[model samples]
Target chain A: MWSRSNTISMIFVALATTLVCLYARGWGYTIVQHIGISTDFTDITISAAIILSGGLAMLCGADLPVVLIIGTLGVFVSLTLAQDALVRYLSLAAVLFSIGVYGMVVSRNAVRVLMSIELMLNAVNINLVAFARYVDPNLIRGQLFAIFILTVAAAEAAVGLAIVLAVYRNMSTVDMERFNLLKW
Target chain B: MGENLTALTAWAQNHSETTAFYILAFLAIPFAYGVLLDRRIIRSGFLLIGVFGAISGVFLLLQAQFLAMAQIMIYAVGITLVVVIALMLTNPRLEHDVNPAIPVAKTSGIVVSILLFVTIYLSLRSEIWPLSPSPVKADNVLQIGTGLLTYYSLPFEFASVLLLVALIGAIMLARAEHRPPSQMEERLDAQEDLSSERNDNVVQV
Candidate 1:
């Protein structure tokens, strides 16, 4: 399957799941705050419905592509359902990390591999922000740390890509198993 | 007893249950998945994310926001990125084949990992975590900045220099040189006689 289509479908599913979870959790205000959308509902009743639908979709022996899309969507929905900022942040981080791991383990493209790592980094940044909110409501140290991490990540990416380029020049291919020059 | 109960009730009222539930779920689900899954990458990634997420939550609950942020940024983001990038540089292909001859080694690795997990779990369970006497002050950022500039200035400068040196080394190693290798041609020439002899043997056979 073309990854482009898969990415789009995954994003759609995530949006739908978030909507369902918000409806179910009776926390319409939370979603409203996140997307700047206003809605009136003291207690929404859509969480159970979405969970059932999602579970059924998973159990239908769907294609791997479909399952991956739904799984990613489910993660997003679950995270957004969280009511507290800290929980929401952690959930977002978890989803990002899991997606990154999936991409790292499944995709063969170098760019995809790098993207997965970036996703994981973003998850950590979210966690940092949440934690900072918890510890000191006034301090922005968490944001600073996140910036530092981003800087380091950028440096690492540069060095890593350079190495990959060098390896490609020498071998004409990036197949890992072929790099056996140092095995002894 | 009445006073203690009132205090407990006040604490519970101030805190959000949704946060606690999410944290617990995140921590438990990954561990369960790790135990049930056969794939190492899946298991490891899930476990790491769960553990880190839980720690971050605890940090938030404990009011050590800066430390928690550092934990997530440094340990979760930095380390995971390094590992994933390393994986990418080495193998872009997601090959699932395992060497049949490495069963014993694989088993040993699994055993060791399980043992380490158990040890850590036990220690965590036994530890007595104390709540902060007072909520963290709002000026933690300023304090951290002051500490970094005053007490940690030398180490910070050294770390920067070390990073620069590493950057230079990485660039040097990765830079492509157009010049022909001096020894490679000589080595190929030396192997020519062996190739010719093998060709002769094949013809004679």
Candidate 2:
């Protein structure tokens, strides 16, 4: 009984690891080097290890979706780390943004979806602050925008959670699949 | 204790910004993954708190001290509230151990996110940013406060107004009755048949 599930999970771990490594190597060497900012092989391997951690977790096991999400973000992070200072910050934001997108798409729970959205907003804030650091250090207008984004994100979360609670009251479950009252 | 504290400060001073940046980003990636990968959704919510904390440290490293503090104060407390709401919404009776996996959505989510990440990364690398030669001053909070009062005064007031609106709107939405007033009236009118339909929405007196 354990062997069957274990075989499938092992296959998933292998696939995720292979996919993440191929992308890191394929992009890590050529395009990243051509750009003239890519780091050494050591860093690339470190990023690959980050992706493999997810693969390991899955082999150790919750399911496939979680592993894929981790792999995708890992690829984004490791590949982006090839660049230097400002670009690294920008790429990290991009990695977080990608994870947020994956979560938004895969999550079946309504609250989880909103949480993914919050992740996406925070990623944007990172970009804004990074730009403030690089582009306009003296005036710091990017920080101002980030602060505004923070305010709006808080407001959005408050309103969104209230809506979720309202939905929960109408229908006892918070599962997105079960929300069929308005479904045509 | 004083000697150890001074030694620690000297050690930190020896490392450059790049070193600090790598350290914090490395510290953060796993927790960010944990936010979505955990089996329990509530657990993921708590994981998000870790992500926020690490990112706030990155903000501090970047010289945006005020943003870092604001991030900690706002997101830490705000996410905890989100987790609490998730707890309230979860039905104890419906908790389960496992599910038959859905593969199609899983594949699509991965595909779309990778495509989007590639697009974002390409755009970021392709463009050349116009970085200023002037270094950021040490007193970031002072600069930010001055800028807020002088340059961004209008938007600052608007954000406060927005927060006020959200506070009132959220309470209104949560307290809102789903069924029409007439259905509610009919339900109240037929007190004899009250036991048939359960009224969870309280009719305010």
Candidate 3:
């Protein structure tokens, strides 16, 4: 249920968010300073900009679907651009991990849940590699850890899918809600 | 004002890598969302591949060439394809997309996910990370190989064993149920055997 005008409005909102984040350079840093965390304010700035855009879109009567799309895109773009380069990478990883969490929680299908879990693992891998790149580039301990995670993730996927198959054969349904056999 | 504009333009031009990062992030996050939120599970399976492929590109950007190749090989090409096949085998009739989650559970799920994310984000922003300034050497693959076979050899061996066990377990679990024939089919077999015996007698006669 998306109209052309709504889509246009959403793009406008996203563009507006980009402009704000790009120009409000030290706003993120200031937020971090107040928080007393050595980390940057990239995450908050992006979240605020996207939330602001969404509110603006609603005020302008942008449809719900358009607003959602714009908000997501705005978050995506700002996530990559926030903070310094190394910190920006970490922020992106955080955003991804959050998305994975949302998926794992909300998905009804068991296999979809597994996919979400993989997404979460990949997000962790991103963080590891980012740290490896920016912090310990010489040793690459982070990359090595990432390799181990990859191995573990592969093993987990195999075991998980096998269990899913067994459950499907027994119950004829892969819905997460239907898996209450273990519940007291 | 003119000087500020010029400085901003120059800074933007110098940060071309950031532009690439933005492009890859755009490619990855939406597809990852599709994997979870798409009503059609089959489409989600395909979208998972897209997400992995983009993540592999991100790995390359981070200078983890070996990890990037492995990501593409193991995740993009291997695991996702397996997932898609499993989805097809499990749900051949497309009868799945209809069951919406109860609103209460759905809302709780969203709340929990948001809480977890907020916690992680806050911690990441607040933590003081130990950072090194040295660049990664050119012979990353060699160093990794040496480390894997030497200092990390125990874990490497364990990982292989784990893979072997998982492969065997998956094969055993996914094998078709060993069901016997029904009574009607058994009776039909008997009748066919009797008819064949009588035909043989006639031929002998």
Clash number by candidate, in order: 1, 0, 0
Cα distance off (Å), candidate 2, residue B74: 0.5
lDDT top scorer: 3
The residue pairs that clash in candidate 1, if any, are: A24-A47
Instruction: Give TM per candidate.
Output: 0.46, 0.74, 0.80
Query: DockQ for model 3?
Result: 0.51
Q: Which residue pairs collide in model 3, if any? A: none
Evaluated against the true structure, the overall lDDT of model 3 is: 0.76
Worst 10 residues of 3 chain A by lDDT: A75-84
Chain B alone, TM-score of each model?
A: 0.51, 0.72, 0.80
Compute the lDDT of residue B136 as modeled in candidate 2: 73
Comparison by TM-score, 2 against 3, better one: 3
lDDT of 1 by residue, A1-184 (tens): 5555455446446655666555544566665556554443222223333334444544543333443444434443443453444444465456545545554544333433454565567557666665555544454466556646655665666566566667755664554446565788
- Chain A TM-scores, per candidate, are 0.63, 0.66, 0.73
User: Relative to the unseen true structure, what is the C-alpha lDDT of residue B117 in candidate 2, on a scale of 0 to 100?
Assistant: 75
- For model 2 the TM-score comes to 0.74
